[model samples]
Target: MTIHLANRVETLTPSTTLAITAKAKELKAQGMDVIGLGAGEPDFNTPSNIIEAAYRSMNEGKTKYTPAGGLPELKQAIVTKLKNDQGLEYAPSEIIVGNGAKHILYTLFQVLLNPKDEVIIPTPYWVSYPEQVKLAEGVPVFVEGKEQQDFKITPEQLEKAITPNTKAFILNSPSNPTGMLYTKDELTALGEICLKHQVLIVSDEIYEKLIYGDNTHTTIAEISQELKEITILINGVSKSHSMTGWRIGYAAGDKKLIAAMTDLASHSTSNPTTTSQFGAIEAYNGPQTAVETMKTAFEERLNIIYPKLISIPGVKCKKPQGAFYLFPNVKEAATLTGYESVDQFVAGLLEEALVAVVPGSGFGSPDNIRLSYATSLENLEEAIKRIHTFVQNKTK
Candidate 1:
């Protein structure tokens, strides 16, 4: 029998980061020493306090369906977190918790978009953005952020991308592939354009707590009251507290939109995991020492490995201000190494050198590749050495 699938499902591309990581695992399973830098997850364990909270929740018989959106306690905690961290206040009614930040975003697109509505996504973007918009029957308009601009799109560029069909602009600061952040002034300028054009802003701040050096994370919604009304702030404990498995994330914005998302989630997922919600509550409300420790470790790793990466011939990288990924332009390296593209170079590194890095083609930067420093300094050093050797030998 010939089975047919929806066109949306047929057209979706598998996540490149996951694909590379899985390939690395397959090689490792065959006894090759694969050093994978493709995973975006932190190598750290969940903080003990959060774990204990989940245990307590399970022991106390809290492992059941929660409110379709989230528990009041969890929602209130999120409200407090937003106020304390970003100085943005929100009522509980305006928030809805989903399985993770990814889920929240997927649901948001479904609720906010109509068929043929357009979303402006700046590249290089998280791999899922364009796919998610397409799943909701929305068109993704890509605006390339030039490499020289630290991979951040300018306000003028944003203004030119807007069309009558444009519904929202997706902003991921301390962006996933590039790890670059937008300054307060930069965000304000962008927000002004969005306001003038009456486009909704979806600000994904999952990496807010992982910043380094003098750079800071700012929410575009915090720029002004008007912007806040049009902005949907998406965040989660996964990146900040190493609670990826906990599966809890929330969104805050217009109450009507929140209600729609909540309704959609009710039928699709019902609610986030009960115990995970409790864990996330503790993650937000408990001591944050572990989060800071993880951030410091990532920063130290970046300090040690970034220079080594750039020291290789035909490589150039902008020092990332936040997040744990290093996106380096390797077009010259690819050309020198006799490869036709960055993807070929990355595949050769994995197959021969036993190192895994994601090619930037999926992130909309075909000339670059993304390496994650979320692993230990020892593994990172070895991976860099392997990459350097591979590049040199290929060139020779």
Candidate 2:
């Protein structure tokens, strides 16, 4: 019998980041020494305080379901965190917690988009954004962020992309592949355009707490009361608390939007993990010493490895202001190494040098490659050394 699947599933592209990580693991399972730089999560473990919270919750039999959106305590904790950190205020009714930031975003797209409605996504975006929009039956309009501008789109570009069918625009600061952050003035300029056009802004701030030296994270919704009303702010504990597996993320926006998302989640996920919610409650309210520790470590790694990566022949990169990834333009490196494309060069690096980094084509930048520096200083140094040697040998 020939079985047919949904057209949506057929059109979706699997995540290239996960694909590389899996291939590296497959080699390692066969006793090959593979060093993977493809993973997006922190290498650190979840803090003891957060873990203890989950254990306590389970011991107290808090394993049953909570409200579909989230537990009231967790929602209040998120509310408090937003107020204290971002200076943004939200009632619990305006926030909806889901399985993770990714899940929250998927739900947001589903509820906000109608068929053929367009979502403007800047290039070098997170790999999942366009795919999720397509899954929701929405079109994704791409706007390239020039490399010289630190891979950030401009207000002019935003204005050009808007059409009558443009429903929402995604803003991922301290962005996934590039690690570039938007300053306050830049965000205000973009916000004005969105407000003037009456387009919704979806701000993904999952990496807000991971900024490096002299760089700060700003939430666009906090720019003004009016912009706040037109924005949906997305965040979670996965990156900040090194709690990727805990899977707790929340969104705050208009009450009607939140309610719709909650309704859809109730039928789909029912609720986020009960133990994870308790853990996240503590993540938000507990002392933030662990978060600071992880941030410091990532910054230290970046300072150590970024210069070495740039020194490699034919490779150039701007120092990332935030996040733990370095997206280096490797087009010249690909040519020097005798490969026709960045993807081919990356494949050679993985198969020959046993170093795994994500190809940039998945992020809509085919001339670059993203290397995550979330691992130890020692591992980072080793990976760079291996990459340098591979490029030199291939070029010779």
Give Cα-based local distance difference scores for all models: 0.95, 0.95
CA lDDT, candidate 1, residue 134: 95
Runs of candidate 2 exceeding 4 Å displacement: none
Residue 377 lDDT in candidate 2: 84
TM-score of candidate 1 versus the correct structure, residues matched by position: 0.99
Write the residue-wise lDDT of candidate 1 on 69-156 in tens digits. 9999999999999999889899999999999999999999999888899999999999999999999999999999999999999999
Provide the TM-score for each candidate, comma-separated: 0.99, 0.99
Show the colliding residue pairs in model 2: none
Q: What is the C-alpha RMSD of each candidate to the true structure, in Å?
A: 0.7, 0.7
- Clashing residue pair totals per candidate (backbone < 3 A): 0, 0
The best candidate by lDDT is 2
Q: Which ten residues in a row have the lowest lDDT in candidate 1?
A: 241-250
- Candidate 1 lDDT score at position 42: 94
Model 1 score (lDDT) = 0.95
True-structure lDDT of candidate 2: 0.95
Candidate 2, which ten residues in sequence have the lowest lDDT sum?
Answer: 373-382
